[model samples]
Target: MELGLAGRRALVTGAGKGIGRSTVQALCAAGVRVVAVSRTQADLDSLVSECSGVEPVCVDLADWEATERALSSVGPVDLLVNNAGVALLQPFLEVTKEAYDMSFDVNLRAVIQVSQIVAKSMIARGVPGAIVNVSSQASQRALANHGVYCSTKGALDMLTKVMALELGPHKIRVNAVNPTVVMTLMGKANWSDPQKAKVLLDRIPLGKFAEVENVVDAILFLLSDRSGMTTGSALPVEGGFLAT
Candidate 1:
């Protein structure tokens, strides 16, 4: 089915690598002009070389003022993917203010700021847009040593609902994709421990972890007209980890 996404302009955060990079490629494949945002200039440059119709914007989402200023120049976008996030593993008892702040700043606050800027533009131009936040399975599940990361994601899930409620009248949809352990470079390195990998995989009924493409597909569905009626929902692409 045609997703009715042709000619639409989209902005994807964390677009340099992993699921974010895949999402940008998928959007381009669907005939969407994409604005890719990441802090690394090299990654952005590489992405532009690899994909057509992608405009790169290098801005650290952790910096509120800089992000706001950078986004101001992006003009208008019909879709926004709040995918830039950092996961810092810290036990609940050992979590520090610095770590907590960083997690929330990137994962939760950046989503809010970016969505706000994009939604404002959408509303101003009377363009009904879609916003998909890249959340994690850790949001709904309590994972040990992921206190700060989990909390930020949980807040993001809630933020999605609130955004949906407020933006519905304007025809701007908001949703989230919560994925299980995806085999990105970081994921491969972290889950390389057989014992650790087995422990996590046991919880997933599929007996495996997720791939970047899996999450990208889910995100595309949410952004496309195919999921027109979907909003304020956390679509889990977690291989049934949440099910069991």
Candidate 2:
């Protein structure tokens, strides 16, 4: 089905690589102009070379003030994807204040800052926008050595609902995509262990992990007119991992 996204504009955070990069490519393919934000200039350069009509902005979201300044130039967009996140895995007992702060700042706080800025613009411009937050199954379920990461994701999930509720009056839709082990370059490196992969595969009733495309498709649908009424929902692209 046509996504009805042609001529629309979108801003995708963490667009340098992995799922974020794929989302930018998919949006461009759907005929949308994208503003891709990341921390790496080289990756942004590569993205601009690969995709047309893309504007790349390099900003480390960890710095609150800098994130605000960098995103101010983006103007109002039809879609926003808060996909940048950091997962410094450590046992609950071993998690330090620095690790906890880093996870919360990057995963949850940055999302609030970016979404607020974008949503304010959309409301002011009278544009009915869509926002898709990239969360994880780990948010809803506990994972070993993922204490800080999981906590941040869980908080993000709650934030998604609140944003949806408040933004709905402004005709802005907000939702989240919770994905299981997606097969991105980083994911491959992290889950390359055969035994670990099998253990995860067994938990998924579909007997497989997710791909970047799967999550991208879900997000595009949410951003498109197709999901015009979807809001405050967390759509899982987990391949039945949460079912078992």
Candidate 3:
């Protein structure tokens, strides 16, 4: 189970909370140097308090110029996790331009922009780095009031494939970890109601949602040499939701 990720520096977006925070902690435990990026300064402070050596950067990924400026100087990231994303749930008929723009900016556009920076560095330094995009099962299956969110993730999966295709020659593997609802604090609160949760829970053959650790484990595997043969793949940690 050794990921062989020790000593490799990684940059993880949306490191303030949920899966991003857990991923940072896992990487730090594996002896990987981490660059944690989140817009909220307080979250960054708290994360560093917990993990100690995390290099925290406060920047909103939705801002094109700001993201570039913040990441331009991080200096040769050996691993990249494009985990910063927003879920602006809206019915297909009610989807607005603002929601669409913000969702696309953070979910898809920022991924391309960030990866461009990291992949360039990897190629230049001859680093056979890996990139893990945090996509969702919502990309494959439709959810009520998640039209815009689904579109962004669907695009993200395609982007992951194309990135892997081009970056494979450089030994820069790009893949996505598509998870179902991970049981973060917020997720638990949202799904605590059995009647509401049953609607989706019944669809999952495993009859359970995933935990942050579940998704994190998958991500580390993909980022490590253990998954060296995996590239341009969207590995699902969705607890058999996709199967049913």
Candidate 4:
């Protein structure tokens, strides 16, 4: 179970809270030096306080130009976890242009931009690295009232493949971990309503939502040398929700 992650430098976006935060803690526990990114300075400060060997960087991923500039100052990264994403659950007809744009900007475009920058550095340094994108089951299954979110995740899944192909020659692996509902702050905020929660839980064969640890475990595996041959793969940590 040695992840061989000690002394490794990792960058995880959306690491202030939720699954991203959990992943940052897990990596740090494995002895990785982590650069955590989020939009809120308070949340980033909280994360840095809770975890040792973690450097918090506050930047809005939705703003690609700003993100690129901010990341350039951080230098080379050994592992890049593209975990920042936003979900909007509304009827397709009601989804505004702004909402759709925001969803795409944060979930899909930002991933591409950050990964591009990090992968370039990895290649320049000749360091074999891994990029793990935190996607969702919505990428494969179309859920009611999640049209825009689904679209962005679907794009991310494909982008993972494209990145793998492009980075293969440089020995950089690109993959994605797709999870079903997880008990994170975001999950609680969106699914706290009894009716909505029930509707989501009923679809999972496991009869329960995933814990943040569940997804983090999968992501850590993919980021480790043990999964050296894994790339262009979308591994599902969905609690059999997709199976049902």
Using lDDT as the measure, which candidate wins? 3
Query: Model 1, 1-244: lDDT tens per residue?
Result: 6788989999999999899999999999889999999999999999999997799999999999999899997998999999999988988889999999899999999999999999999999998999999999999999999988998999999999999999999999999999999999989999999999999899999999998888988999999989999999999998999998
lDDT string for model 2 (1-244, tens) is 9899999999999999999999999999989999999999999999999997899999999999999899887876999999999889888889899998888999999999999899999988998999999999998989999999988989989999999999999999999999999999999998999998998888999988898999999999999989998999999999888888
Per-residue lDDT of 222 in model 4: 95
Clashing pairs in 1: none
TM-score of 1: 0.98
lDDT of 2: 0.94
Worst 10 residues of 4 by lDDT: 185-194
Candidate 1 lDDT for residue 216: 89
Q: In candidate 2, which residue pairs get closer than 3 Å at backbone N, Cα or C atoms, i.e. clash?
A: none
Per-model CA lDDT versus the true structure: 0.94, 0.94, 0.94, 0.91
RMSD of 1: 0.8
Error of 2 at 127 (Å): 1.3
